[model samples]
Target: MNTQIQRNYEAAKQIYANLGIDTEKAIVKLKDIKISMHCWQGDDVRGFLNKDQDLTGGISVTGNYPGAARTPEELRQDLEKAYSLIPGKHKLNLHAIYADTDEKIDLDEIEPRHYEKWVQWAKKQGLGLDFNPTCFSHPKSDDGFTLSHPNKEIRDFWIEHCKRARKVGEYFGKETGQPCVTNVWIPDGFKDQPVDRLGPRERLQASLDEVFKEEINPAYNLDAIESKLFGIGSESYVVGSHEFYMGYGLTRNKLICLDAGHFHPTEVVSNKLSALSLFSEGMLLHVSRPVRWDSDHVVTMDDETLAIARELVVHNLISKTHIGLDFFDASINRVAAWVIGTRNMLKALLRAMLEPTESLKEAELRGDYTTRLALMEELKSYPFGAVWDYYCESSNVPVREDWLKEVKDYETNVLLKRD
Candidate 1:
């Protein structure tokens, strides 16, 4: 530990002490919160199916940056490097397509054994694993639909795939001793206006029912459904709109996934957390920075992200929320992208934890709006960076801007060497 960092942290602690907040307790609490980091960013959403498939599902990864992981081993290596720099024990979010086998395993035929390597890896790292059913980037999803496809055969294929994915998720949960959140997100929409939207939604609901027919123990696995407003090719209409999934999640007792970029440009996902937590069993958050559209850019310490952390802390919904990152930016260093996004997320959570919640609530309850606003504004200038630096130091990860040197060294010695 650097002496300078400890000195700064102690000073910051005293400042927080004056506000009736314990900085030490905040750091300890932050350590317990684990953010699920997505695996797709390392490979630009290109899984090791070896089928020469193009990305579908109204999703696309722009920029042909060098050194994208071409194999499961490389991806895991990059993830390990990234995780070593991030504080706290975290979870890895995997898609069904990231199976570590060389065999031509069809999506419908995938089994838990296919992901045994990932289970073993997570076990070694003492990390939990979450899962997703890849309903896109395959021949079956060429029509910009899967679960809601007009063809029963295609829909059945997707249903079977989701069933297998749930089983895999259960296996992960059992192995890691944490509930695996199995999320379902499909790109079932139309580029042009669809006259029969209700038909597709009905089919989708039926498909979901069939997929989730088998009951898995809540201890092992939980189900979640994600909705998207618009995508690259599905700008005209999205079948699985927010209203559709919100209703389904409430009625079916499933976790509703709220992607930061899945709603309108003006819609704040942070604002919806409390409202949804009131009815839904739980919720999955896909944290990403969207540039105008649903472009999965790396997250930063932006207002929206900070607001999300604030909501989770203020509402005490951290336990009920399954936090996960969902972004794929191939333009920069892939490992650096993971470190930046994950660190920013942790920082936001830390900032929220260091808030003077008790005082703020007391002021609010007493109808002291002026003091509430003043305290809120004053908190913006707190020595959050000092606390964050202390956190990185105590967690044994690189502190502040110092972590960049390690990334640069890795890029030179490892990434740049890749053809």
Candidate 2:
């Protein structure tokens, strides 16, 4: 460890100790929190299906940066590089389209054997795996509908695909000894206003019921459904709007996935955590940054991101929340994007864990609003960087901006060589 970093951490430890916070314990807790890193970021949301299909649905990757992963091996290698730079042992979130097989198999025909290599890889690396049923970017879903499609055949196809995805999630969980969260998100809506709104929602609910009919062991798999306010093509109405899924999740007793970029520009996901945790068994978070729309930009250490971490720590909701990154930025080094986003997430959680929660709670409970607000503002200027630096150092990862050089070197040596 650097002498200066150690000195700074010592000083910060003293400062936090004065506030009744233990910086060492904070670091330990931060290490325990695992953020699920999405695999789509390395390949620009393009999966290795050995097909030439354009990205459809309401989603799109903006940039065409060089060296995007072309095969499953390359994507896994990039992810390995990324995981090395991140601090904790995190989970890898995979979509159904990323099945590691050369055989020509339809989505509905996919089986756990298709992902055996991924399971083995995760076991080798000691990483947990989460899953998503890919309901977009397919011929059957080109009309911006899947589970709620007007055609019964199309709806059944998606339902079967999701059923298979749950099996894969079960496989991951049983193999990794952790509950795999299998999330379902579909772009079923209209680009223009539709005459019949209730029809699609009713169909969606029925289809979901069919999909979840075969309940896997809760110890092996957890089901979650995601909602979106709007998407690029579905600007007029999204069938799976927040209101729709909130009702569905509550009624169906499933996890509700709240994507940071899936809401209105002004809406903050951090504020919703507490209220949702009240009734739900657990929740899933798709943490991303949206500039003006649902852009899926890489996450940063911004105010909203920090607030999310703060809320999770303050409310003690970390155990009930499954945090995951949900962004695909092909504009820059994909490995760097992963490292930056994951590290920033860890930093936010570390900052939250280091807060003087007891004092803050005491002030709030006693109706000492003035002291609470003042302390909240004062805590912002604390030496959070020092503790974070110490964390990276002790965790055997790069400290501060030093990880950027390693990513640059990787781009030169490995990524740029790819045709």
RMSD for each model, in Å, please? 0.9, 1.0
Note the Cα lDDT for every prediction shown.
0.93, 0.92
What residue pairs clash in candidate 2, if any at all? Answer: none
Error of 2 at 38 (Å): 0.1
lDDT of 2 by residue, 230-272 (tens): 8878999999999999998998889999999998888999999
Best by lDDT: 1
* 28-75: candidate 1 lDDT, tens digit per residue: 889999899999999999888743899888888888878889888888
lDDT of 2: 0.92
TM-score of each: 0.99, 0.98
Give the Å error, residue 286, model 1: 0.3
